[model samples]
Target: MTSDIFAEWLKRQGHLVFKTKSSYWYSQAARTFQAFPYHRVIEPDNNEINEFLKEHNGVALRYSTPLSAKYGKISYHVLFTQSTYSIEGLPKKARHDVRNGFKKAGVEPISFERLAVEGWELRLDTLIRQGRVRAETQSAWVKQCRSAQDLPGFETWGALVEGKLVAALIAFSGDDCCSILYQQSATDYLRFGINNVLTLAFTNEVLKRSDVSQIFYGLHSLDAPDSVDEYKFRMRYTASPVRQRVVFNPRLSPLFNPLTYSALNAVHKLLPGNPTFAKAEGMLRFSLQGKKPLAEQDWPLGLLEQKESILKQY
Candidate 1:
């Protein structure tokens, strides 16, 4: 997909994104604090990054994979291939849970041409408050979701029990890939494994499409919670390390060092209920300076190789 379209999508999702002469900016704000997830550079080089850093008063910019290693640090993500994945590929326990979930919920998955945005937002908000959904929601996000029905390649797949929506997946299809951008289910149905059922149903629907070969489930770090990581692993996603970059503001150097960041992160974990404080803490941690630069040559060639293997299997 073109950066222009992706940037527009980000805006539609309530992120403050804009294109610069040489890069795309994704500005994130929490309360009164502002930060950038990373600048997407058209032609990434040391000079371009330096220029961008200068423009942003030395705020760090994140880039993906190989280029990130050359210009920053390394991170990782789990990728799920839709073409070769099926319910049978999941772990026995996971498969059983999904099957049992459908039986218990007494509902079959349904594809929706469009779902009511306000209702969807209310369900999502309820899930978020219960900590079942990790994503933060804003008022603008709900407004954007309502407007997104007119956007190309955007779709929502949902499951209802006796006419009450229990689970939903918001997806976006690009030229060659389909991404599950957001997912939520009612907290009351967690025991019934509605999350698993929704995922399976959504994947099955995507598999029916002839245009997409891969499904991107966003990012997952090695240190991610066991519940989430294991769920994705059981669903047969392949993990690969991708590079990430951070450039700290020189004036705030002391507060943005690794040691300080780790300590603050510990404190932040204790204050989960205070999102404004948590977000401020995250900004400091994200802007921390790495002790050493990652090696550039160690790009995850295995990710590409794995993708090729999956294609061959198909």
Candidate 2:
């Protein structure tokens, strides 16, 4: 899809959209937003990116292009192609999960316009609490979802067992891609593997639509939990490493570099039960960064073009 279309979509969801010589930015508030450079067609020069970064004051800035590494460090994500959705292409375990999920019940497309907001909120809140999702993040998600429910081309689907909603999936459709924005399952029915079943059904439905080319599974870091990483791999999704940089305001650079963040993350992994430390670290990381623009630096100019060519094979 064109940057203009995407920008408009973000605006409909309540973000403030603005453009610069090298990038398009969308923000919901003063200290948070994401920037997408004009890199889909032409490479942006350092001056343009610098100018774009200088205008924003956020604790951390997220850049969405594959060229993120040139400015900072990289994070990888999974994007599924049509071939990856075929039953034969899935790993044995994943195939089994999908089959078992399907046997329980089928997924059906649902109109977000018809869903009761209060009911959806109760279900979402319960999922967040059970999954231990951060409260601030959960709040933001609920707000966004509520606002975007009636947007054009947005789709929501769910699976029911004994006439009760057990799992749900939400996606935004674009000209050439569909992004799975949110997927959740009821905590009480975790054993049913409803999430996997819903995903399989969604993939199948997307494949039938000739206009869609791929599915963006969202951002994933190499340092993510092992179970999460493994589940994606088992489902036959491949991680395409992107130059993802989280530009930290200069004031917070010393405490938020890749090395420091990685070390802190590793420590958290080792001490899984320490929510106190996790909460404290998250606050400190954002607080020390201040209200400066987070800029990604050191991008290799031609790497994104080369990577795109290579990715086309999948």
Q: How high is each candidate's TM-score?
A: 0.73, 0.70
Candidate 1 lDDT score at position 196: 83
RMSD of each: 6.3, 7.1
TM-score result, candidate 2: 0.70
TM-score winner: 1
Give the per-residue lDDT of model 1 (tens digit) for 1-314: 44556567677666666444555667655312122222222335666655655665544454443433434333445566646556788888888878878886543433433354434654565546455344445555466556556667877777677777777777777756787766666767777777788777777777888888777775532122335545666667665555454555445555666677677678767866555546556445433422344432232333444544432532
Per-structure clash totals for the candidates: 3, 7
- Residues forming the 10-long window of minimal summed lDDT in candidate 2: 290-299
Any runs in candidate 2 off by more than 4 Å, and if so which? 1-9, 28-30, 36-44, 64-71, 114-131, 136-142, 221-226, 249-314
How does each model score on lDDT? 0.57, 0.57
Give the alpha carbon lDDT tens digit for every residue of 1-314 in model 2.
45666576577667778777656777633354456421222245546545455666545455544432234343355677754466667778777777777777678986564333423653565446444444335445556556666566678888877767777777777757777766666766656667678877788888788888887766543222435545556666666655444454555557766567567767866765455445434433433332222232221222343454543542
As a whole number from 0 to 100, the lDDT of residue 186 in candidate 2 is 75
